[model samples]
Structures are given as C-alpha cells and as structure tokens.
Target: MSTPSATPATPAARQSLTMVCATMAGAIPMMTLVLWFVLAVDGIGEFPESWPLLVVLAAAVGAYSICELVGFRTPPLQYSNRPTAEVQADSWRRFTASTFTRFAVCEAVFLISVTLAFVADSFWVVLLGAVIALPLFFWEAWPGERNQRRFAAALESGGIPSYLTGRAQD
Candidate 1:
C-alpha cells in the first residue's frame, strides 16, 4: 500500500473539478427558477390538497438526507496497483458518479415539488419545495476547495502502487 501524502490535486484535475462545481452551482438554481416560472405561467389547475404535497416534500427531504449521508461517508473510489495517472482517472470517475448522484437527488426534490405545484395548482407548494431543496442543493452540490483537497487526501490514503509513488515495489 502507498503511504498518504499532503500533495494536492494536479492543476488540470483541479480546474476540471472546479468547472464541474461551477456548472452545478449555476445549473441547479436556473432549473429551479425555470420551474417556478413555468408554474406561474401555466397556473395551478386542480389536484389533491396539502397531504399529497406534504408527502412528496417529506420524501424529497428523506432522499436528500440519504444521498448526503451516503455520498460523504463512503468513498466510491477504489484503490489498485496501477499507474498514478490511471488511478487518479478512475478515482475521478467514481467521484463524479457520486457527485452526480447527489445532484440528481437535489434535482428530483425540486422537480417533484414543481410538478406537485402544477398538479395541485398551488404556488405555495412549489415555493416550499424550492426553499427546502435549494439549501440541500447548495450543501451537497457546491464543491469548494476544501472538498477538492479532501478528495485528494482520500485518494492518497486509498493506496496507489509504489511504482507510481517512485518507491521500490515490495
């Protein structure tokens, strides 16, 4: 097993990660706003009452909570005796997959709430959902420098081949 290092992610990797974060940060809010606008223009026609809305809201919250808990606690990336670059690439792919899963959960919450609003013809329901989901989105999807560093640390600790680390193979 390779020893952990304090080394940060490579520049290109860092930039790509930053771009992913930025894109997610922008896209989620825009999606919520678009949904809100659509709801407003289309108007709430008719559907069930508060009970259905509450249920959906609860489910959304539950899903978000589960995703957050799972995503952060578990490192999806696996360690192997491969070239450093190849290992890094595999780790990045796993990280992206995990991140996207969290993103989807957030998106689902907003979309479900918006759909509920459309069905129930209640702007308040949509508003409530968006308000609830927005924070979750920011919390889970907003990748910052800290996150990048943590990911790098995790990768280091996960054990790369000694050859990659310029150490003699055991």
Candidate 2:
C-alpha cells in the first residue's frame, strides 16, 4: 500500500540512479590510473601494457557495479537507518560495516591498480588510476555525511536535462 507520493523513486530519480551507475562505472579506472603510472615509472615489473591490465581492470570494476545494480542490493558502503530505528547498537554496526567496506574496497582498488601497473609497465594507466581513486577515497572518506551533499550535486548536475534550459513554466 504505497502511494505515488510514497514511491521511493520518481522518473527524475530514475534518471539520477542511471547516471550514478554510469558514473560509478567510470570512476573505477580514474582512481587506479595514478598508481599504475607510478609502477610503470620505476620499471618494477607489473608488466601491464602488453597484458592490457587497464582493460581488465575496467572490466572487473564494471562487472562489480553491474552486479550491484542487477541484484538490487545496498552498497557495502553508505549508512541507512533501515536495520533498527529502535536500537543504538544496530545503528552503529551498520555504520561501521558501511565505512569499513568502502575503505577496504577503495584501498584494494588503489593497490590493485599499482600492482597491475607495475606488472604491465603502463605508467599512464597507473597514474590515472591512482588520481581517480584518491578523490573517490576522499569523497567516501569524510568524517560524517559530507559526501552525501557532493553525491547529490553529482547526480543532479551530471544528468542535466537538455530540455530544462531557456524557458520557464507559466
């Protein structure tokens, strides 16, 4: 018994969701690129260009996100009050779990980019990857709910409609 007004998502919301998914899809590589570049610089031995590790990294990230979207599950990051409005403990658990997961994943992705870039010998990929990951880490790493504000801005602006310009409603 949900009213239209009570619906969790609207058409505008759906558009936002789609943009988010796409952006998440794109973000992975950017985060890892810098590390890959650093690895490539030292000739340490990750050996990626021949192996095209960047391509594979892209695929892995894309796959992870596609799975999340298709399964309709919450991200291991982000806090929500759905578990228990009544208990203080459960709320804390959810909060810890969300942050822990995001931190681990962000670190892992950055490390993986470095590892792959070292092995692949692709400095460009590594550098770009690290660059992207660093900001995303910060974006997710705020002390409190600060990221939400940025997330809202990203969703709203990235999907700016072509028809919403040059006129006002009567």
- Give the top-scoring candidate (lDDT): 1
Q: What tens-digit string does per-residue lDDT give for candidate 1 at 1-170? A: 98777754354644676587678657656766676576655564344577757866786768677764665544434655567667656655655665677777876777787677767766666667767776776677555544444444544554443122222123
Model 2 misses residue 47 by how many Å? 12
RMSD of model 2, in Å? Answer: 13.7
lDDT, residue 114, candidate 2: 61
Highest TM-score model number? 1
The TM-score that candidate 2 achieves is 0.40
Q: What overall lDDT, based on C-alpha atoms, would model 1 receive against the true structure?
A: 0.61
What residue runs in model 2 are displaced by over 4 Å at the alpha carbon? 1-53, 56-86, 140-143, 146-170
TM-score of 1: 0.65
